[model samples]
Target chain A: MEKRYLDYIDDVVSRIDTDSQTKNKIKQSLTEHIEALIEKHGSLAYNKLDPVEKVAWEFSENLQLQDRKEYSYPWPRRYPVWRRVSQKKIFNIPLYHITDGYNPETGEFEIARGIFAFGPVALGVFTAGGIALGVFSFAGISAGVLLALGGLSLSALASLGGAAVAGLFAAGGMAVSFGLSIGGFAVGHIAIGGEVFGEYIYKTTTGEGNAVEWFRNYLPYFVKFFQ
Target chain B: MITIEIRKELKSGVIELAILALLVRREMYGYELSQKILDLSSGQIEVKEGTLYPILYRLEERGIITSRWQAPLGRGKPRKYYYVTGKGRQYFAGYRKEWNVVVEFMCKILE
Candidate 1:
């Protein structure tokens, strides 16, 4: 309603990094709020308002802008204590065990051992973190018997991650498998991806190719393998 | 007095729960909502319009609440009325439980 308030609103809006639609919505809401305040106060001049009212308006505008910045760039937000903590062991076991380093006493290059282990060289029934080997593994580099999901997973029956190599089904950015594989670059008995090199390949980018017959033929075998 | 930083952080954390709890009873406009918070808190909690609106927008985006513009019967600008959605109620129920736990723990520790 007033020029000063409109100027303040404009300044606040300009600082926000959101899209035009959101910006407009915020502007409309803020304008309506100020208008309502004016109606309640029975005054057009901001200076004429009570000290408490003035402070409330100022605090409201500033805090809203601060919150916008916080939300837009959420990296600075405080995480819970439990989420921040990282562990190398479970139940006092040498899970992140290492050997063959400068100091053996420090447990460098040691083979890890635990139910859920994580380390440079780890082994467990269900393991994760760096260089993991387990029944169900997830790591930067991992190998599992049944299922593996990680950055560079290998030697799994069913693996899903980046750069995966599996015996059965594999899905990743770059996958190499004996059975069906789906990725950006796949090579398998039945490969499906943007760029595939296999006997029965299905390229999705160009939308040209026929792997339906191959899939239909192999569907029963695939289901049997899973069973 | 508690430091401004602590006050800000505390307010930010609990404001959503407070607003949702208040809105469980009835729909409210921006000014009315702020005033109700003040009244309910006995002036202990103050919901600034600036902070209240952004939180409302975020809640709306998450489909926790819905808003509609209501025209005045006389000759004033239409006001946007906000109502908590079913999703909001479900979330609030869980949040309220967690909040009660925190409150109980704090009370025990203080005692």
Candidate 2:
């Protein structure tokens, strides 16, 4: 086996510099500006061009595009879309809306909204981000309709996280719900946890408020059958 | 006479204010805003055309302006558009006054 020759020197480390998160925006801006210039002025006018225009005209000449193609997307012109969208009559929406605004890459930010959205701030049917709101959301703090799982989660159905509260069932370190609850500290109609409290609760060791009612209603029938 | 280096530095200094001023008139995308600056200044206020985005991002972070994505003619591909916020309008008005003061003071000495 032959070792491949390396062109550059050792991978250096411990370099210090202020990496402005805006570098990504600059990069994206340059790319679009060049493309736009080429689209507006074909190579025939290359001699009259300057700055980024020269490169754009060169591309236009080389590519032999009589007309520069225009993208529908505005600034931060390109988005990472999962599939090629098909034109429909009834409704239209992208499947995924995600951006890395803080990473100094793609240099853009918007409330990400799609079927599946991921960004610093996101909203969708299903979303994950620092702060999220959707039908089903997962983030540092989230609120969802069906389910929400995060540090602080709230939902209409089942909410699960460090601290969770739901309309129906909830479970976590601190859980509160209406129907059933199970966690370290649970509160619901039927509760089960280390420290549980509710209207009719069955804690780990024994049933508390409604235990006597169950014992009275069923115990006499069982005793008669045995006799 | 302003040297090329000094001219560039001066132009860059007012670039932020220029952006806010124009955006106050109407919403424009990044490229359009850059081109408008070039056209209005007759290519005199030339900075690296690509540098505008970083400035825009910074301005946005400061709540001086805001941005949104909209498709041309409300159909097909989306494009991000920028507009001045209420804070930005007030900002430009106040800053312009300060800039006028600077110009008057500078003229007293340099002239």
In each prediction, how many residue pairs overlap at the backbone (N, C-alpha, C within less than 3 A)? 7, 8
Docking class of 1: incorrect
Candidate 2 per-residue lDDT over residues B11-90, each given as its tens digit: 44588888888899899987788779777877655434434665677788899899997767843345568998999888
* Stretches of model 2 off by over 4 angstroms after superposition: A1-23, A43-227, B1-9, B74-77
Top-scoring candidate (TM-score): 1
**Weakest ten-residue segment in model 1 chain A by summed lDDT:** A78-87
Model 1 lDDT vs. the true structure? 0.70
Among these predictions, the greatest lDDT belongs to: 1
Q: Taking the tens digit of each residue's C-alpha lDDT, what string does model 1 give over B6-35?
A: 266667658888789878888888878887
Q: Per-residue lDDT for B33 in model 1? A: 88
For residue B70, give model 1's deviation from the true position in Å. 0.4
Show the colliding residue pairs in model 1: A97-A110, A98-A108, A98-A109, A98-A110, A99-A108, A99-A109, A99-A110
- Candidate 1 Cα outliers beyond 4 Å, as residue runs: A48-227, B1-6
